[model samples]
Target: MSQQRHELLPTETHDELARESFVQALKSHIATRVSPGVREIYDHRVRDRWVSEHGAEPADRHEVREALSADTYYRLWSSVRRSSQHLLWSSVGDAVTRQADDLAARARVADAGLGTLRLDPDLEIPWYNAEVDIHAMPGGYRGEYMAGDVSVGAVYDRGVYVYAMGQMGALNDDYGHSICQNLLAASYPEFTPRRILDMGCTVGNSTLPYVDAFPDAEVHGIDLGAPVVRYAHARAESLGRAVHFSQQNAECTDFPDGHFDLIVSHIVLHEMSPAALRRTLAECRRLLAAGGLMVHADFAGYAGVDPVTQAMIDWDTYNNHEPFWGPMRDMDLVADAVSAGFDDGAVSIETVLTGRVLQTGKQQRAGQLTLLVGQA
Candidate 1:
């Protein structure tokens, strides 16, 4: 199935939609049919060769990569996986570019009087963001081609649904939805937040869930991209969600100290540099009121995974333009949070099952999301 259509999403031509669907199918095939072979090759072929040479299995993800790099099957699969990513973006980008003017116009009139959008032209884009197109997404998240360009945001809103292979639910909102429904409700039943903030809220996919989950709470979302926040505000307004959208760096937002009762981010930490990640955690501490909860959700760290598995998961860092993926996995998030002024006892990492399952053409995959949770 395709992504749920919203006003801010570009209208794909019939052929464009088919191309996007093919890309999705190819990704699903890779995940189900081709990717599983990596483990089999590593367990039997790569491991046998490594043991013959060094008298022990690959010691770390580095060695695991070295071993896999030599295997013809692995190389072929890797090439295909990388190509698929480029194709995914090309397919989505074309659709957005085709209707750039239309999208900008729609964004201009999308307000349903639900929320507000604030932008900062002088806000410097971080070096990390300005230097790389994090996902090889064309023009990245901040590109503004025209006076009121929302094309990049439209592309992202559609692209992520495909990139996640529909595992993030129909609206690509499973992360925020799951956190609110599964984690917060069970953990802090009596804690009612008056103001909530979502950090690195690209296109506001994860930010909108808070509006539905906490109807009375004042919800806000922040991102470094001007185009993204512009589209995010419009998207929220079209969806009847009252979410304040702003263009600001998460590491140094203008919100006053103790301005929020709850802070959350979804899979955004891996996109940041080490310094930014640390500063953001500290910023979260500063923005949160006493007894407030801070939850940054992303993939779990690579402390206990097998070497081969780690290498496999880290392939994105090398192939998909996610430079910080591997480094982010190696970080000690709990310790970092403590260093960010959180009490040692107040922070911990927990893994929670996704509130939804990924359904792909008769295949169902259950997923787990990790949380770096802290309390102020």
Candidate 2:
């Protein structure tokens, strides 16, 4: 007799097939666009020029092209992977835009929100402040600024919209939710959260997953970007999820002491300097009730991974304008969490999808570590 099949097998098999097709389509699209002339110019003008002037090592243009193609494929696949459930939810995107416009209008007349802040000169913060053009989006966060004036934010918003289209009906947050949900179910089954906070929740990509995972909890998402928070709130509301989106810095949230049952951040730490990271950790600790858990999902150091994978991961830091990523990877997360007053044993690191306890202190020497989950 044939072996019994798991109930999830059919769906899993279909998903894998869909992912494979999407990857192939992405690869074909990239290959077709990367004409020989374009490749030559990118190689000679960009790669070779940087190598000679900056003393950066030269990577073969063909190899780099192949890598770029692969990266594009993976990014596209990952984007749609998590949103498979809502892939048919067509109306949510429209709802998000409509809600955003309403919220933006409300924020303009109000004394608070992104409309009031003065840009810090020392921070070199790239987003706009006074007018509704956080990051130069027209009507900035308030959507009052004209699109022509806020070109940067407009382009950014367009990119997000385009990506969301590809996501079908999935929540707009990072693919982290599905991955984290599976991981928690398999690895940490003992914890049941009552209240959850997602930090640096730009546009709510990582925040909505917690709501799905812990249906009973009040999910709150905070970010420093006003426009992003407004945009995120609208998106969440459109999806019919009750997520409270607020504009607040992760370094010092205004929440009262020990109010949250779970605190999480995804792909947030690398953007900060060491000092900011410390403050964020302190804030996370302060917000967690006793026995509450804190989990951060971010990249791990390339300390122990195979050499090739490590190099590929490290390349992203410089090539993608993620200047602080390398430094954060080098920093010891365990030590950082311990310093914030969590007991050593109470803090643990694991993979968010696999439920595997990551070998802490083991660096991915060659390849970049994918995801690290730190608990406090």
Candidate 3:
């Protein structure tokens, strides 16, 4: 019996190493297989369309498309693979759960902290009313959306994307904020913001970045989910960031009129319905101090990309449970922003790379479009 145990132990260790090696190899293989074709598609279809229609320099779209395509492919692949691995992890988690009732106890403690906030579950927020689990998260944000239930919304947000590999889907909201900060700093150097507000900041991921970006300014974040707000506040506190998080709807915020120098939404707009988006935009305009800027970082339609790229973006909306995404992308964001009260010349869309740089034509390419409003 002792000899058998020793032999099995060595075998187990070998298997673990082999599995890890296989995963790494699979990632490398997927990258090599998908990247080149994606790059070609971007260079030909995406770049040509942007330059021809938007008056961007020739080859600009090409370079941008290559970088963006790689990033998108990597993110999508990682998420899918992670989901695949979850079957194993889930069983392991179950075993761990059995062994350690401590996790449950911890979750209960977290739940207690969230109980102070009153959230209206029946309030019927239009943006969250969707049938499909957007981004393939098993339970979408609205599925278990509840106040005082720390595990529901919080779990859904973290778990739904559990299968997503390597911070794919930006892992957490903080990553999204970091992306925004980097994009703004690199793309729009002229805009010096003083007061910033991040809407739908569930965990202050989007809110904390602004605080870091502009230390001189006051940063605030608001969300309707009380548990999420509580969690966000706790997280921010733990991170040693002084961010003011409130439980409120973005459409009708408690903030004073014209209070913020910059109003930003990271991946929040598309979740909203058309009417809600319009209302949010109007609220953004109303809350912006005169000459304050609104920087919205989200999806733009793949009008110029190849059929495959277009299909990939659209597939997530249909297959991955993002019902509003397709509709949101179809809407004219620039037009919507203008209708909300920004001047005609105030809004401009510029692309930035979300992934590694790759070869392209002479023109510089932007990976994703960042719509800057309020000034040129």
Candidate 4:
């Protein structure tokens, strides 16, 4: 489903800080319109044409992408959609950059509770991170220009709303908020977590809500981007939430064995290589306390979805700079969880509806989604 039609877009009145110009806003709107139409054309026209000529459907997203890659409509959609993504960043970055120093200063003294920020200069950034701008951002998420800099993180905090066309709600924390409403509230009504970990938490947008959900829990957010974590720390402070932000990789962490009551990630699977994902899961299993839980919410089911839809999703794999999107989504999570030492019978999945989704008046979305869940 299109995030635009489902979730409301940010308006001039709602987010004056973004300062979107008429040209940039128009480009972003055009992109939002193009993204869904690309899928519509694929589902209605191209897939039908392929079936008519071949007598059989394309087996997967790759084949679908290949078949449509040469089509005029598909080419135009890719070009315009890609340009719009850049334009969205430009609109937010232009405004956010001007206040980078001020943001950094605020973040430095922003914590409201017994929270902390930890950075490891000796830590090595993974090759996937050092290799390319994963999301078509000019310098990438981890890029840092100076000490105590929050420019990249500030851009991300606002850029994501622009990218999602404000579908994530006012603060853009609905992705995390969804877990509390769907999985936490519905699945484990009586379970009370003592400690929580948000792995690969970029700006802690998805990390902050667990504090509100379980006020007594010691919440910690981890990622490789020092600047983002710095920004996240300040953000949690500004929101009056207690979250310890740290710079670390999820594949291997410094936490002791069985240290946390809950571990979670939101839409983080498609960002890493399969090996990294596997390693991360294994580490998650190691970090969870006995009787604790681990759950990760990802995108629309990859292998389970129609080929045409899968092809549309693959647009990220090629056009959006998400190199591992295809393999990560296509992975066999049950088997992967088993490989990670999670009990075979205890491993399960759920498609949780995000909170913003509920406000869209489409409560049925709760069942149509999926989340990979495991227990220690």
What are the RMSD figures for all models against the true structure?
2.0, 11.8, 10.3, 5.0
| lDDT, residue 17, model 2 | 36
lDDT of 2 by residue, 1-376 (tens): 1111211011124544355345434433333433223334444454565456547643443344344334444344333432331232222223334344444543333332211122222322323233223222233333323321212222233333333333412333434454455566667788788888888776665677777788888888876655566555555554556777666777776789998988888677887777788778888888888878787877767566543344444544544345566678778887887887777777666653322222212221221224434454
lDDT by residue (299-375, candidate 3, tens digit) is 67656665445544554564455667768877887888889888887877755445322222333343444554454
**Which is better, 1 or 3, measured by TM-score?**
1
Residue lDDT tens for model 1, 169-228: 778898898899778988888878999999999999999888888889999999999999
- The TM-score, computed over Cα atoms with residue i paired to residue i, of candidate 2 is 0.58
TM-score of each: 0.95, 0.58, 0.64, 0.87
lDDT of 2 at 191: 78
Candidate 4, poorest ten consecutive residues by summed lDDT:
2-11
- The 10 consecutive residues of candidate 2 with the worst lDDT sum are 1-10
Ranking by TM-score: 1, 4, 3, 2
Error of 2 at 273 (Å): 1.2
Model 2, residue 257: distance off in Å is 1.4
Task: Tell me how far the alpha carbon of residue 86 in candidate 1 is from the true structure, in angstroms, after superposition.
Answer: 1.0
Worst 10 contiguous positions by lDDT, candidate 3: 1-10
Which regions of candidate 4 deviate over 4 angstroms? 1-57, 356-369
Clashing pairs in 3: 64-365, 78-165, 79-164, 82-163, 83-163, 174-205, 352-367
In model 1, which runs have C-alpha deviations exceeding 4 angstroms? 355-365
Residue 184 of model 3, lDDT score: 66
